[model samples]
Target: MLATLDEQAQAFREDVLAGLSAPIPAVPARWLYDRRGSELFDDITRLPAYYPTRTETGLLNEVMPDIAARIPRGAAVVEFGAGSQTKTPILLRAIAPAAYVPVDISGDYLNDSAAELQASFPGLEVLPVVADFVRSFNLPEGIDSLPKLGFFPGSTIGNFVPRSGTDLLRHFRALLGTGALLLIGMDRVKPIERLLAAYDDPAGVTAEFNLNLLERINRELDGDIPLDAFRHEARWNDILSRIEMHLVASRDVEFSVAGRHFRFSAGSSIHTENSHKYGPRGARLMLLAGGWTPIAEWTDPNDDFAVILAEAQPNRFAP
Candidate 1:
């Protein structure tokens, strides 16, 4: 395995470099989860205004043992985008995985979580893989003997567009192997006002979280994107059942990168993130199409989000 920058990864970076000059303010959503972006997201979750993290964490806390019961014995527990692993120990404690694989790109952050989890769990082996989870992963060779159980909480599944979401889940299912399990957390559709409030919080952590994309570009690509020149915007699209986050340009500007100058219209906008809010029926249908059998699902009393367990479906998705 190339181990990093799979074919898709190579193409995506090329697309972004080309798209940067196409008269629009645009960046792919994957770039927003780098170390700094990850830190900001952790901070965002801690903000009182951010309810999804706390509420979903609470629901998972109550239901994890039952969730663990669904796992086949001696299963390896794997988590994608396993940042600080804030919610991991709960499941790990309950199921007590033979191995815990936390996949993340931030080495420092990933190692810290791995050390803490390994130290606390005593017998469980904590494997920290420091690579972008959006790219394909090579599960460490050590745990191949055990069955796999995939855990992805924090409602991070909502970050993808519908098609991309299903595709990634399919890839995830294949990686986990036959009869493998998938645990997914999703934000469900609700009153538009409530959805809007969650993203556009009073404390502005969400704003920082959204705008961190610019900072990532500035820091990594060596691009000069004046943070103050862009405005963070969030809106609820009732029709699509999604909350769209965007960065709007304050005025016309030109940027140069890799010896290329890209121009943006004065009022242009770059789409940052899309958090798909689904109804229960819709979520189940999506999972079914993606070849996962929705075994158990739970929702908070307020009806804001859902955490679901699904088993791998047949090979490919047609529906």
Candidate 2:
């Protein structure tokens, strides 16, 4: 069942409070997707600097025929995040899933996207579930008997650290059940310059997208944060092999969120998000650790991105 707005808000409030109190202040990237944040993100994808969306979309179009051949007809496709209007349609057209379950935390955006997608695919079942896909949630009834095909695109998996990402994949494996198939996108480890450009776009749309999280906290959680006091900064953490987004305080500043006060010194930052790129072996190893055996993979000529197809094989004892 979808969480009530109050419940969702409370969760957001709790996360913010706890995150701020942590030794290394940071917030989860998922909270960055409130309605306005989602819209900003949609804009970010269109920017010239952001290459993942365009690269992945073109690759999906090219590989759908091969993907379709392997996926059984009438299987239900449960997309982990909000279904992309551009990309989801391509998959729906190719595989013709009997049902498409889009699970996202942004309730309004999820419903709006689901409605538009349902319009496009009149015969398909569109079940929109508003819940954190990272945590447990019940899939809408009636797709239980259908063969399951999990669609996780856009390399959102990169947002989590490797350990969390593996756990998330395992969660998907358990939720989708044994014998289900997963089509996932993984961003490749690319040039540091390209990675920085993608996250720290010249156009500043990425800046706005990053700043919007603070705006969301203020609007939703009674936070009195001075938006101007903080600026968006993106850095490539070489040791971690990830791009980290941080909101740095321009000067010593103090803020109150939900009646709790917090202070930051000049240059202190709240680490907001991470995007971890992967090599071929690392991606496959992570999937295997999460209980999926990769069967096929496709990549662009430049090797900028990848789309991998894996299946949940039955558990067996192996040395």
Cα-based TM-score, every candidate: 0.91, 0.98
User: Measured by TM-score, how close is model 1 to the native structure?
Assistant: 0.91
Off by over 4 Å in 1: 2-15, 22-25, 316-319
How far residue 6's Cα lies from its native spot in candidate 2, in Å, is 2.4
Each candidate's lDDT (Cα)? 0.77, 0.93
Q: Whole-model lDDT for model 1 versus the true structure?
A: 0.77
1-319: candidate 2 lDDT, tens digit per residue: 5677788888899999999999999999999999999999999899898999999999999989999999998999999989999999999999989999999999999999999999999999999999999888899899999999999999999999998998898889888989999999999999999999999988888889999999999998899999999999999999999999999999999999999999999999999999999999999999998889999999998999999999986654100
Q: How close is candidate 2 to the true structure, as a TM-score?
A: 0.98
Clash pairs for candidate 1: 25-270, 252-266
- Per-residue lDDT of 1-319 in model 1, one digit per residue for the tens? 3234355345445656866755654566766766677777888888776788898888888887788778877889888876345688888878877998988766666677688788888898878787667667789998888989888888777888778777777778777775788898998777777777778888887788888877766665567777787788888877777988888889887775545666676678888788898888888887877778899988888887899999887785523
Task: Give me the displacement of residue 165 in model 2, in angstroms.
Answer: 0.5
